[model samples]
Target: MRSRNSRLGTAAALAGLIAGTAMAGCSTTGMDASDTITIALAANPTGAFDPYRNREFGISEVAPFTHDSLLYKTPEGEFVSRLAATWKADNTSATFTLTPGITCADGSALTAKDVAAAINFASDAANASWAYGYYTPTAPLTAVGDDASRTVRVTVAQPYGYLLDTVGLLPILCAAGVKDPDSLANRSNGTGPYVVSAVSTGETIELKRRDDYAWGPDGTTVADAPATVVFRQIADETTAANLLLSGDVNIANVSGPNSDRVRAAGLDSADAYTAAAWLNFNQREGRATSDRRVREALVHALDFKEVIAVSTNTHGVAAEGLLVTEPAVCPTNAVAGVLPGQDLERAAKLLDEAGWVLGSDGKRVKDGVPLTLGLRYWTDRSELERPTAELLAARWKAIGVGIEPIGENVGGLVKTLYQTGNFDVYLLGWDLRLGSQFIPYLSGPLPPRGQNFMALDNPEYVKLSAEANATTPPQGCDLWGKAERAVVNDFDLVPISNRVTSLFYRGVTGQLTPVEPTSLRATQ
Candidate 1:
């Protein structure tokens, strides 16, 4: 756990890691007898293989190997060159020097033309993906200068503080895949470390090392290592952990009761964090939660620390804000003291003032209507969603409000929670790949326009989010912190925990393949 000061010092620390790359160089020669490394993923790719569109969390395990980006972020949170040789930027425009001779899997040359094409294709609104909101260019990002120059110029409508961070992701694809992404199901069209050699739909995904891949991050080549990689989907947590222990699976991500079992087994493990799990309130009309006071009451009624402890088996943090991931330009503790404490007296009073009064049936009522909330939670996403919802129902019941829990399946979570807007209260979360991914939710259009599931239409927030984007990091990112504070102050969002996923490894050589994919290589 690095401190704020250490986070500030990460640029230098990460530089040293990049500078001393040769000593840690990985080899592809020592082929294992099995010649493959198998990992147990949490779920199958629940959506289609459009690299630019909205997809499931399982995509994280697959995409990094198939698509290479211009830049890569070191685990310590600093930018390192990947396909790009050098980068220089200002508030409005940034330039990337595409490395000399990188090639896509089809043996075609990767050029500045390919980079510009991928950005333009994804930035189009008709793509119906999060990238539509993620990359908002007044004019599309284009390739500027001749062949010797080799630079892609990024121009935002205004100053975008996190532009550098955003470009580090987005999976830089060649023209072929961008033209016909559907045809990429069985082939390798990317410039990444591995090629998709085999796919069995939901059962398995296999990738073979790309021998010609020399353009990895931090001046290190990883494509030659670990002859083969395989991802196996095991829906049950206990079963996944057992597979790792029995050598049927080399690695597994375990949480709740299974995490303790993995740790007691004495296998290697590391900490992984994702987006903060939030209690999202649907502010649409015809819902009792449409009232601001009702939303605030729901926030304080639950015992959050205890709820997180019970749900995570004491392996979670009470999230102070949405930006819980570390080493960022914005101060991580900005929302520290803003969250409302769990106080039953305050919750009861707030509901009463909002015209919801206790009745003979023991539930609060407003104009003969009982104050009951329909709660939706993912049934298969985690071992904790149902229990967390049950605990919330119990706590809210003690405060005179009733909650009816509806279990949401994995394949239908997005449609059920965001599209239908059928639930008053729901348990939801996201993975903030570049930190600024949270912007779309604050500004509305719900699912299609953005992931504004709460249907928030805060003009001040919209203004602040835009203002934040118009500045560079440290300054612009600080504005984002202020906007998030405004969101928490209203109690429209209640964060229970910053999810902690523990990855256990048995025969995994060197660094384990991350829960969030990275440019890491095997030592064996």
Candidate 2:
């Protein structure tokens, strides 16, 4: 193992790659000198523009362009105001005052009604927004207008001090655009600087700037935005890179390792270690994984370095704790990372301790049954799951643990097996954008609560997770440290590594900072 001080050095050295082949066959004619900024989405939103009910896709990128969220995150990951200028909270209630003169693309003024409608939509049972999980505010939204004033007021049903930050990214919707209150999905009524021009399934989506728009915490003016932005859904990574390198598109969101190829091809790239690649354990299943000792053994059996090598470049930050990075909470005594390599001796010890012994086929037999598990990967076969799962299975097999590679219809079977806790083991990922609830992946699925599909129930971890979520920013650093330590000590779950979001840009487009995509300043 490399010394702790050399972790980053090792990561950088491991990022080298041989010459790559470009795959995107886009037209190079108009794209070479075009003013339009085209972005290639790695994966399109699952369906529609709703964030609540859908578990994956749609909200993050689309919302930012078509709707002005309450709070926005700069590419650097800092939060800034969008619709609500400033907010305050007391012991029992939190309130947000709207910024004046903000208008929808249709020229309708943004008001308290828009804010209320948006939140109500998410909080409503019918909407089923996955974004709702991050919102801690349970208060029924009460919209009020000061009789003698044009400013509006928003109060929670209960005291939720962190409501503003929790609902920070909720997009305010124009009431006029919402024709029915009962419908869970709708699109294009947002008060952002841009308006949706068209959305085509499995192809491309487009947005047009609102010439009269003027509002962003930074006082950004969209009066001069490009006529339109076309987001093409290009699933192939090599193809996307080829387009950027060949000057067929203005930007492409490629992987970290490929960033080198883009530059080698005479283009530029920008990247941020945004999220991490992780394996989620379906706890509902009762098998070798049902035991903590077995889980720890499996974690120790797989070499994370190899996983990172095959997965992507950047060695993606190796995460020992749940909250992939800082500002995301961790326990006070959290270890920097979990076990990194296969310790056959340790794996055997853990297996022996759990009363499992090797059988004739070289697989462990516990209670008259071979410790074999059925593992499933997404059939879309896109993500790094295929190789990661194969590597994991191979390591476990060497340690007398049998892992059965199950090929099934992608989404449905995987979800069914996990939710019902019927499979021996399953692999998946949980997005960490909901920073504070780092432990919910484990806690939410515990029995009775029923969300803890993993069925991992520990009083201490639950307490630590709750404390972390309830913590305020002033105590953020300290609280996170405490939470991280607790999670690492339990060894209840294994965290792989953090992921970086890569944006590929072709030739020059003015003097925009690579860190900032598309626009120069909020005002630009």
Candidate 3:
């Protein structure tokens, strides 16, 4: 592993930062910052705008602007009504009161039946939703049109107490868009405040504000916004930050040393929490990390506090569980001290106990095989991911373990890490922009078929999760809390950083959360 070189761009960013700061104070601008909110994205969407098929992180960030959901949640996981003006549900079913007279981008009026069809589409077993397990209907979900009642009724074939939690985040689609999702690669038809005008792969997506749109969450409307919103894929974090500073772009999501440098340049910012970075151990046979003890030992080997400080620029804390930071459905401290502290001696002892003895090179070996872990991480993901991998390698090395760090682009991660099962341990982090309680990890599809990279098969977790899904409110959330604790406490996955970082932008009015996909932030 290469030595920790901070942010890879911050040191060189001094000049760019200075120039950016100086430029920010000037009014020599050409673009109408008031008429357009240009966002500098780290990467382009993988392709298309199909809610069922688009699992790319970049796309998730953009979907909300082009679609509406039955409900909404703040980044903190606080639930609120959305398309469904009033929703009431039981363990097995839900009924939604449709907002009167809302229209789709197609100029078609929305109905309760439309919302129900969306829920069914998203929950299909063949769907590619990242949270497929959470949204997958245990039984067929059906929608009944009841215009006289001014409501749409959806019945979950089986028990589903927390169905709305996952259902609420789904972007409701028109019948045509749902039938031919590929058509949305460059177009859209939804109830959102904007319609995707054009999609330039690897470059930009242009959106024009919907003058007819008036139904926002909680009966709100977009009173202040640019007539057009432009999303630019800059790829480089420093470049994005510099662009934002130079008024070339109004908003950008940047983190680590880059985030520090940009904010130091005096830009307005919004801090929002994202899911924690984590380590997923491949438990398939012949992989060294299959042993649970080894996983726990590795967790104990690193001083996460030190790693996080360098990685997040003090924007994060050591994570306790999957629900890292939250206005979450279930908030608890299951992670506090549940993990073994950074104790090399303890790690060494655990390795010794596990039959991995230190050899002449001071690296642990079992039988004739050395304990070398293959670590794969996303390339150019953030300023933190690469350095974090290096620091992690160093920490494990200090405890007589060997790790080979490999860099893969975001697109390559799913193929290499999950499909090919190419690595023993891989770096993964979920952006819980929409809270689904992470039920997929316990009972979702395994690699090649889905994103369950860990392949964790815990029956207790499944039972608890099932029970939780069939219950309501705090009861369901409370059960999920137990399941999360069970998996995490067993050291199935290692936590890295749980952070709330500020998105530095200009002329944006409403607050936004990195985790809530449907939370649209408009201009002031």
Candidate 4:
């Protein structure tokens, strides 16, 4: 999970010369070992591996090996310190006490400066990090000092709960030596147990264990340490499961639909509730989806039960909120009455009530304009998106709506379409940590000053989302449930299905399957 910047470096000859010489000093003799483990991710990483590292695919692979955050969530969804030994927070600011004697891979002692630098990098508009949701939450963070007494200070615009959980995952870097933010953003330069040495994006990421590393959750250094960790990108679940079965890889993230196949092949299965598949509607002109009523009608047409059956083989749960299955955000009671099941009769009634009529072409029309919509699905050449889009298009077409399933790279397409305001519908996935992380989608069009693409402006939702952030877990659950019910009643955003990630491993023991609520620290 090393960033592309780490492998690609700079195009200049100066960087080339430095990289060539640095490559000579870096060795991989321990990478190929009988005790070493290899895992496969579903997609290629989108660079940016620092806490500022926004990509989920990269975080899934790299977070376990190279990055150490201030706090990590336990299997029970409780927060514990990782880089910082402890932290104290008040109404305005949070003060952190760094774990003593921490050093980066190159042997430079880690300090408050590195942590501050990583936060600064993530907050930088130029870096475009997805991590700003926690670190720069309408506040400025300042690092206080160096030395063993290194305490960092973070000032908030307003008091909010779950701030610790949000900031806990920001990775610490050696800020003193890092002159290039891009290099640090893309490369492995942290105080974790392992340091990435060689990376071939979409192929393999190689990490070497740090002998001097002594920090761990069990109050001692790891004893049974592997010399190296190799992570490969295997987008195809069947292929990845086969590799794990054949002993090519030690573990692989199998798709929910393919979990039974892996179990049948005699490999162990560990289920992780990480993300969900949801549809994004573009608020733009020349699209039938320009009207909110029309969008609501379209959502009403989707049968989440059928989606779970046909798409996931009943391996996943239907989503009740924008953020799937996280109890703190979309509590057990909140999700119970919110799933969007099929109601074709109700859907037709809504469309007709909205003044859209069945036209000669069998498509819905309003004011002599046919209801034509553009639906872009991920064209990764993998079966993940295309098949789902085909199913969705078929359902929509039957409802007198012209739905076109276009193939495109969904990541960039989402950003591009959002900004251009030219498309109608798109499919995307979101991974929000339990509690406050789910607030962003409800607020919409994040990055603060940016667009809230859905054009959904509800004073009530905004207040409830903030309250959900300001309150503690169980209490927050109650407040968030009310907010979730309000949003569903308004038909703001469509909740598709809660995705279940299945991991197949050969030598792992115990219940690796995660408990209710989701976080990567749980699995490790």
**Best candidate, TM-score-wise?**
1
TM-score of each: 0.86, 0.78, 0.85, 0.81
Instruction: Please give, for residues 322-362, the per-residue lDDT of candidate 3 as tens digits.
Output: 65434455655557767677887777888888999998888
Model 4: worst 10 consecutive residues (lDDT sum): 7-16
lDDT of 3 at 504: 73
Model 1 per-residue lDDT tens digits across residues 336-444: 7887778888998999999999887779999988888998876555667678888888988988898898886555665765567788987765434333556666655
Worst 10 residues of 1 by lDDT: 8-17
Alpha carbon deviation, residue 29, candidate 3 (Å): 3.6
Number of colliding residue pairs in each model: 1, 34, 3, 1
Q: What is the Cα-based lDDT of residue 99 in candidate 2? A: 72
Native-referenced Cα lDDT, model 4: 0.56
TM-score of 2: 0.78
Give the per-residue lDDT digits (tens) of candidate 4, residues 1-524.
00011101100000010111232223222333323555555444555444444443223545546767776655555666667788887546677778888887667778787777666665554454555553455334444555556787665656666556666556565664345547644467767777767766545666676767666552346445565555565556677667666666656556655667778877766564433346666554455565667777777788777765545546566665544323233343444566455778777877888788987677888898777788876443224557777788888888898888887643454455444554577665444435455444455553334335555555677787777766666667777777766665555555576545565676433323321101111112
Measure candidate 2: CA RMSD.
Answer: 6.8
Judge candidate 1 against the unseen true structure and give its global Cα lDDT, from 0 to 1: 0.64
Q: What is the lDDT, from 0 to 100, of the residue 143 in candidate 1?
A: 38
lDDT (C-alpha) at residue 214 in model 4 = 67
**Which residue runs does candidate 1 get wrong by more than 4 Å?**
2-34, 57-59, 134-148, 185-188, 275-277, 433-435, 510-524
